[model samples]
Target: MSPIANAFSIDVEDWFQVSAFAPYIDRAHWHSLPCRVERNVDLLLGMLAEQEASATFFTLGWIAERYPMLVRRIVDAGHELASHGYEHHRASDQTPAEFRADLVKARDILEQTGGCPVIGYRAPSFSIGAGNLWAHDVLLETGHRYSSSVYPVVHDHYGMPDAPRFPWRTGDGLLEIPVTTVRWGGRNWPIGGGGYFRLLPYNVSAWGLRRVNAVDQRPAIVYFHPWEFDPEQPRVDSANAKTRFRHYLNLHRTEPRIRRLLREFRWQRVDQAFSDELEKACAS
Candidate 1:
């Protein structure tokens, strides 16, 4: 703990809605899938309460539409409510108009269900990169104050290696707070929470975040999903070996690792953790 309250976030989507499963799990069948989000989220909430920690939940409009109470529970528990778009479609794959529509639909549903204005957005799969820089302007126009949608690392699925690792003010004045990464051997490597957290040892994740906080002197932003906490989540057997490995590896360790992280680090909602940068973005 570097005496900095790092930003902690949860992308509120079910296991079936993950991008890796998109090839197999049809959106049409999403409604039919047994949703474990509510239960898993409750489990997370209980742990957070035990640790007396707060986080930001980037919820889906589709989930909010069906589980309004879940949205309310997040708000009622003293966490910030934000949007993760209408569905799990990546912003990079959609036209600007489509992105705008998805963004608005998600924000509106989140505001209504959570009873608070949503100012933060995280593109599904960390999807807004160089090709979709235009998405930031749409976020500005749509009243989003900030985004944690960019990952400044090299990955097969998503990344923009040259992007700034810390929170940056976009041309549109929307603060773009990227997921945390650490620079070593002239490359940006992801240490931000997600599958990477599950794939790697807990000490490695802690070391990366500590380095970012100590060297970069900036509050690091990390993210996870409710499904990540549920090791028993329905296995997507249809997914390829790599996908299965990525999604299911070390599932049992995730909860305890998160618990240790909470105990060791000073975590806060994104808005609170990066308030100064957000204020600067607005002022600019």
Candidate 2:
């Protein structure tokens, strides 16, 4: 099996995204909008099933309430169901109490609907950086076993550049799995995930993944949102130029590239891959 099999993740959100679009799309308007979460998720479920692969779905709680069937479908299909907070709010914007409450509400809803323990988390916008690293404790207290929230690279929005690249224990024993990147000449570059996977040439991304696996000999965690596949999604009228560009950039190519990725790498849910690695670690 390709080593990349061990760390694939899927973020379940609508086309109106969190980080870039939050400033443009007001929270109040979210409910009134036609729900696209299920439609996009169905697209992904079909793709993954065709490849006989599974992944962790970090679902937004708001979407779960509106489309509980989608959450159940994910569980029924043997994918891991996990929380992506009640709303797409940045962890840094929330105080610990607010973050804890938001997470608890999300976890309760996801666990009840999915009929599975929601043990994984990926913060909206990768917002759980050094400023809010203490949020890790809140996550453990709320029953999450691992998080894919930290982006260990310098970016305009979010990153903790010095954070460990692989899964490592946080202060509260929560396993923090930073997204995968390759280090070259002391510079770390994002590989096949999110916009990087979308905007960059496919061959360049493939080589980046291959390089990381070759040097680290560890499974590289890659992530993408379901909304990425919805090329013809209704456009929300908004004024923030940056948000519009980030959300709409390369939407047409995302799904085809993702299909190619599935063919190239063995992919599975993060929790399942982690469990397998843990067993191997013990054996050795």
Candidate 3:
């Protein structure tokens, strides 16, 4: 049997731009905060280089406009540069017009900065839900070939429990590749990365990926924020306790955990790792 190749993705935003910090830190003050994204992303680049791995980075246009060279560096390193919306607004918070405009602006900025046609997207904070399924059409119309915006697990902020845990096609023929989750205990548990990677034990996280690879017989998609590796980053004090814990817990350990994960499994960019699955999905 062949090894289970996984899709490793990175969401390229700084510490202050996390969706959980939105309520506490207004967008107007974003420029005033210390920018730590470039440093952390550079760290990710070195780590991936050491492992000989490629990844997909869903980047914000706001970041690209300020650091165009950084976006170019990601492309130079042979990673897929995908859009993460322009201003980091959730689909649920925006009208269809707003979402469409965001998509165009983001795709244009990413393509211009990275010098490659942006082929994928990841909605800010996985915000695509029943109320905003209209965003799917806007995505296809905007020319994205795929999206990794759906998290099948149930979460307080975003999820679609009935959604497929694997890759599937939207009604309009756009491939909707959901973030990884494992079916267990009559619920979809998040195994994709992000808070779950920090909150759970590393062995547990590894086990879930292994199970998804072994039992589900499908490639698991794992994603993390570049900020996860930066434990020295300044903290935001105004967020609620739940949000703070979710964002800050186990930060110092994230880099080592990532190194271990890379050594333990085979991973590549979303398009490369799941090409077969995506081809089958789109054809149907």
Residue 152 lDDT, candidate 2, scale 0-100: 86
In candidate 1, list every pair of residues with a backbone clash: none
Per-residue alpha-carbon lDDT of candidate 1 for residues 1-284, written as tens digits (9 for 90 to 100): 57999999999999999998999999999988889999989988888888898999999999999999989999999999999999989999999999999999999899988889999999999999988899999999998999999899999988999999888888779999999998999999889999999999999999999998898888888899999988888888989999999999998999999999989989899999999988888888
Better of 1 and 3 by TM-score: 1
* Residue-by-residue lDDT tens digits, candidate 3, 5-41: 8999999999988888988898999999999999999
* TM-scores, each model vs. reference: 0.98, 0.94, 0.97
Model 2, poorest ten-residue lDDT window? Answer: 275-284
The whole-model C-alpha lDDT of candidate 2 against the native structure comes to 0.84
Give each model's whole-structure lDDT: 0.92, 0.84, 0.90
User: Given candidate 3, what's the lDDT at residue 129?
Assistant: 75
Best by lDDT: 1
- Point to the candidate with the largest TM-score: 1
Angstrom error at residue 214, model 2: 2.1
Error of 1 at 176 (Å): 0.3
Write model 2 residue lDDT over 193-250, tens digit each, in one string: 8988887899888887787777777778889998887878888666477667777789
User: What value does the lDDT take at residue 42 in candidate 3?
Assistant: 92
